[model samples]
Target chain A: MESSSNRLFSARDLIGFAVLIAIIFVVLPIALDGFRLNLFGKYLTYAFVAVGLVLCWGMGGILSLGQGVFFGLGGYCMAMFLKLEASTPENTSIQSTPGIPDFMDWNQLTALPAWWEPFNSLFITLIAVILVPVVFAFIIGVAMFRRRVGGVYFAIITQAFAAILTILIIGQQGFTGGVNGITDLRTLKGWDIRSEEAKEILYFVNGGLLIVCLVIAQYVRKSKLGRLLIAMRDQEDRVRFSGYDVASFKIFIFCLGAAFAAVGGAMFTLQVGFMSPTLVGIVPSIEMVIFCAVGGRLSILGAVYGALLVNWAKTSLSESFPELWLLGLGGLFIAVVMVFPNGLAGVYAEHVEPRLMALLGKSKAAAPDSAANETPAE
Target chain B: MFSDYTMNELGAIFAMQGFAGLILFSVFVLMALGLAIIFGQMGVINMAHGEFMILGAYVTYLTSNLFADYLPSVFGLYFFVAMILAFIASGALGLFVEWVMIRHLYKRPLDTLLATWGLSLILQQVYRSVFGAREVGVSIPDWMMGSLPMTDMIEVPINGIFVMVLATGISLAVYFMMYRSSWGLQVRAISQNRMMADAVGINTAWTDRLTFGIGCGVAGVAGSAFTMIGSTGPTAGQLYIVDTFLVVVFGGAASLLGTIASAFSISQAQSIMEFFLSGSMAKVLTLLTVVGILMIRPQGLFTLKLRK
Candidate 1:
């Protein structure tokens, strides 16, 4: 694993990471205004989910369409804490139950639900933001993978989970914020999130967190486990025959994806100032998959760019000609799958990177090395 | 919950709920039949299935309006014409889609899912642009309107019975076509062993196109049937996509009988639960149960054993 990790990180990998860091941390902030920067921040949050998909769907070949379920769980956990902080007795004096959330009051509840009580403490909420989704993913992963469910069956079942979670959230309106979601989230422990300064700060926080996660994702990809995941993906029965507990590896990768998505969801709440059932549903989950696909399913860095590019396109296209956005996205999906199955990363690796490497004789040695390793993936 | 009602009232409630369940079952069966054929036979996901259904529904809508405006005296006969037209319109589009898109994705099942999802999104936008965002309803003929009163307290809508009959007729027709015809034999042969079927002089590609077309045409008919019980909208098809998929998967993807049986059980479970709980909760429970069962039995309820 160490030798493989060392071999995986060429000077090219460092250059890629450096460029990504500079763009997110330096270039984007300097170029865009606060509003657009904030929107990019929101998009970056989704990049978290895409990066996770690279690990789970791209590397491991386990596509969980219900990543939104984990994202929603994490976001809601954070939002609950924020909501509780905002609903201080003095803040909600107009309500019948002053200390409780306005929705709970509107629904005629005098006391907070036991489940929500834990979220009042920010530490517990933070832990829960990551823990809850990972736990849920563990249960789902254990059940399905242990029973040898993979491919289309696994995809459909995860989608069904997304459907179930959405309905549950919408149905349990009082507790989960229903269709409108938890709104009016003003402060995070006396620091107002609504301010411009806070938004910029949260953007940096999001960018920084993303880099850290990217490092972790790259580490996983370079690890023996990563190669094992690829092996299992290409030939599951062969991997299982060679003394590997395939289901355990699958469960671990799935839980890891859920944790990443959960963190992203929490950051989404912080930066966006609200979390809703809308983010936790089937549509958003599938959209997240497209982000991974468009970026280059197999490339971690490409996924981040993919998320930003897709969301940016979505915001711009839907803003001008709302009807055309769906058409465009649909067309993009077809183009991505039919024409460029490897996505942006694949294009870069095949076309752009090779040309660049040929221009710079230094890259010639590493090119053949990576090309040998990626033959199976091709 | 039972203690709240008197014995007679409880009996009436059960009967009423059971009848409602039957209507839901008809809908599931109608939708799932087409899905089972496409998914089970050809191994294409066809996420745009609901859109195809909506195509049939829009055709029905157009046919109904045409009858009211140009053939008022023969309006009662417009439905049969609409069903036929819906079938043709949807089948043609399905065939076109198969040729252009689905043919390219035979080796990659997961990519097919994503590609078809893209197709569904495009179809949804097309429908939205053409039909507008609002839900539209087709007017039923005079004979299809009103209800049949079985008892003083338990009355069933005539349209519910009509949908049931339509579902049954289509199911039987599909069964006969798939089991009792040479085309069905060809389809079965292709599904069982494509290379052998090709070597034996069956045109595999043509059969695939027709099978896809017929599957989508059945969905069109199902959508036509849907206009009886619910309104039509561009995204209405999305609401039922997961449920229909579950029905097909739960029934054992390749077996038509399994599809019907799974639809029956799911719809009944959902409708009965709806009587005692909120609609969304009932739906959540039903879907959760199906998913849980599927995790344990991933092959579905009725699997046909095949060589690897």
Candidate 2:
């Protein structure tokens, strides 16, 4: 196992990771064309969301179907900021717009609500991007976890939360952007979103953020809590018996995952400069799962990989077949589960763990009872 | 005439809203029943449950198309055949899945979730390939489509009543099967104690597959019924997954009584709220209320002895 650890840390795996990224970057540009690369930025943002899901779902035994809640939370937070800044009397953006936003006009609002105040500041917007979702998750997680709501019940409840949130946003229309969602921003920090450079920068920024997330998740995976999370996944009862308050741990991870998703959602809105009720709805929330599923939800790398692949396939297929994408994406998922069940990350983990184990010469000590601790997880 | 008109308007709205809730209740019941069988009988968290329901819906869509083109004169009657075929198709797919994959992974309940999720994606894509990506409107017949007039002012949708009756009858039949029949006894025994059931000479494998088949089949029935009122698309089942799961879990994993109670409560609450408030606010309030209540009572309406 010492050799295994050494082997795992070998330069080859590092090279492999880089090579994969390089291939993705090169191939996406070539195959997708410039216009398609514009769409790839959105896929990258979704990949960011997939990472959040991988944590709560792939690692922890929590099946969070409402990740879109955090994603939308982040997007709406950013949109609030843009709307505040863009609402100046001199800015044509605010001209002809009634009371507040057009939706609010319809809702018969006479003035901007006080809650809309902090949104004008980029600083406050950044703080809100993380704070709101964390606060919401904290409250909800505390409530649900204290009572020990879990399994299919927990997943369903969270999903309902996502569905209801979208409806609420749409219904409020004025403050929340309603069905039209927040759109047509002039610029993000003086860079035209419609410009090619801005789009490319958005892509690189998303890609880089994904990498940072991967490293942080990796650290977490190797930490004490990570192993504890695995234990919780395998046997929460046993873990609880071990004297750890299981609920707190779940709450901690859920909050962390929400933050990650919020970051992604915030960046996504910055890139696209739009937010819509559909983005927060139940359907897109489930689509996040497909990204995790095909990418191998258990692996950080798999989460991003799944996101990029599924979204890429969707864009390409939707363009060519216009309608064949769903069939293809669905079939691909079944095939991956059937043939590549480990997911891309699972496949990576298999080779990386063994070789790294051999290189580090740790396998020699990992002899008889090692298998007992190697819990096979979902 | 003035009193009659006023009374008629109120009656019509009430009837529409009331039956809409009933239809919603039926959909929840069918979805939750399939999920409960798998989760309760096999103890596997089959997250792909919604996909199965979607499968049934697509089958209904095809059946609708087939009838429209080939059996025009008897188009309405084709619905019966479609329902049966959807049941068989989804059930058969379930059986194939059990044999090919799920059988090996039941021990890992949560792992099966991810695998089945992948399987769901595969199924959805297959549907998209065969059908198209855009929503498919499963056309109902004239008799099924029209309304039944109760008073000059109040009209009840024929389809809504038809669905409610169909759901009630199917649910009763399933209930009888699970509680009254020999096979049902075998299923309960296995779910209660799989090792012990096998020790007692019950064919555990056969039971697992059959239960899974029936679960998926019921989902198909639910899916087909959903097409009557809901949108039909490659990913249509995604809409009901949460509601269905909520009903099953809130009801209690293996308890049919729990499902019905949960379904009735949630649907009625949602529908009534929609009548009073905007649709979105109603949904938000309903969910928030469910979550709030769940925060206190996690085992849901009925407490099952998952006292492991």
Candidate 3:
């Protein structure tokens, strides 16, 4: 039992987790005002996707560029429930179809669509928020990984899915709120979500959920399955020769990544008040990958910071110099791929952690060595 | 929907939509041919290929203005000059990008995708800054305007015919350059076995740069043709990038014949469906079908069987 506990959380990992918890649950909330905290909360939602990418892309070598689809699926699921709740006959009495969402009424839908029937219940919607994307990922994973389609091909195909989903969403605007997306989400279970206090509460809730996801990701990373993933990434044929069902592992990780992105998407809808086709497109999907890439794809904790830093940079930079932001982002993508493939975690392990260890005067050499060794020698 | 139209009217609509699909097919062929050469032969995913094409379009835009302002008498011939200039401009940039960015990433195809995506974003911004954010249209030569009358009800735009001709000419040229030329032989040799090709005294690096250049040059000409059908914007290239990638992949990445066949099928399917459904729905259905087919046949419609 002691060995298992140690395997799950080493001294170094515990320290990392504690720092992350303080930063998310304490530091940011104490330092920033409500508005800024809400913005950070939105950014944290993306960290969910980034963490999932660490498991799928960084560890499993499955570079899915269409994570936005899962994110959108999750968001839309939440949005559907919220829209349904907000469309109580009393609330939507102004519309011709009183109990249906305003967008549906406007689109001439006389009744709620049969497929949307399940989302009327929060319990089902919550389940669907995770289940829908996982199922989609499962289908894609079984189709591609089972056939041994991977690397650049997998990336391109996933991107194509993003495009297809975006087009489908936009084209079925009457059914999907069109380009405007599902809007005017008022309350969740009679709670006023638009209030400042509610916003702060949601921010905390998002942070808590993100921490939970990070722990789950870390647990996966520490397991024997994690070692197998690394081996498969490095040599698929050899792992297959060793009688491991490589496709099953790949599918499992992909589905888990989908679930993470879905949760983030649902949180985004709750906090941001709407979900749109824009979030489900190719561009946003690839940008999510960059968040993972910037974080150090291999590190779950780093994924959170990566999402925060890049998004904070984006919000501030694009606000000031819109054109320069694209140029800067473009440069970031190139530099990340070329100069620092391992990202922030790599830099930390290589340059910062060692000095800190020396400063602490702890002669426990194995910890720092293991941390350094984890950085791929590419 | 079919019951509304008489047989003769339906025939004319089919002809018109088929012609539209043919024009779309030409564009896909032009774009995918360049990508096939770069991605198929080189094994590098140049996400900035669309930007390279847009570079050609911008060059054409400049050339047209130059002719209309300084030498109105020779304005009719400016398009030919623009095509050559666009090819050189884009091809030179391709060569430079290959040397500076791509060569280092040859062993990492996925990294090349990200880097080229960055290159694309930078190029888009540069275009936005230089050309302004709004899309720019090239004024067509007088001879290329109006329509070519076919049957009593069927008339095709002259510019569409011009783009089709250009696409056909370029496709043939690419086929010859890739298959019949010694340079093509050297490229094939390298793609098959790089170390062995290098050992046999081939200048692999220079050949790679030149091959990348020619691919971009063809994309330049595609951009030149593109101006005939639609306006060019800074982000216009992005709108085509996904579709172009799908075309190349669907055709089997390495086979030029496969690219053409896939382009033809996809374009025809999309245009025909567009007549019946909303444009966006048609696009979604077509793409969904392609992706579904791809899932079933991951190697694509045609593949070069090479030993591991």
Give me the candidate number with maximum DockQ: 3
lDDT tens string, model 3, A181-225?
999999999998888999899999999999899889888888878
Each prediction's TM-score against the native?
0.98, 0.84, 0.98
Give the CAPRI rating of model 1.
medium
Instruction: Give TM-scores of the second chain, every candidate.
Output: 0.98, 0.91, 0.98
Q: What share of the true interface contacts does candidate 2 keep?
A: 0.60
Off by over 4 Å in 1: A1-8, A358-366, A369-378
Give the per-residue Cα lDDT of candidate 2 at B72: 94
State residue A277's C-alpha deviation in candidate 1, in Å. Answer: 0.9
Clashing residue pairs for model 3: A173-A178
Candidate 1 chain A lowest-lDDT run of ten: A369-378
Model 3: CA > 4 A from native: A1-6, A363-378
Q: Which regions of candidate 2 are displaced past 4 Å?
A: A1-43, A93-99, A102-108, A189-194, A200-212, A290-298, A322-324, A335-338, A349-375, B1-16, B44-82, B128-146, B151-153, B224-233
Q: Name the 10 consecutive residues with the lowest summed lDDT in model 2 chain A.
A: A366-375
Instruction: Give the clashing pairs for model 1.
Output: none
Residue range A319-361, candidate 1, lDDT tens digits: 9999999999999989998998888988888888878877877
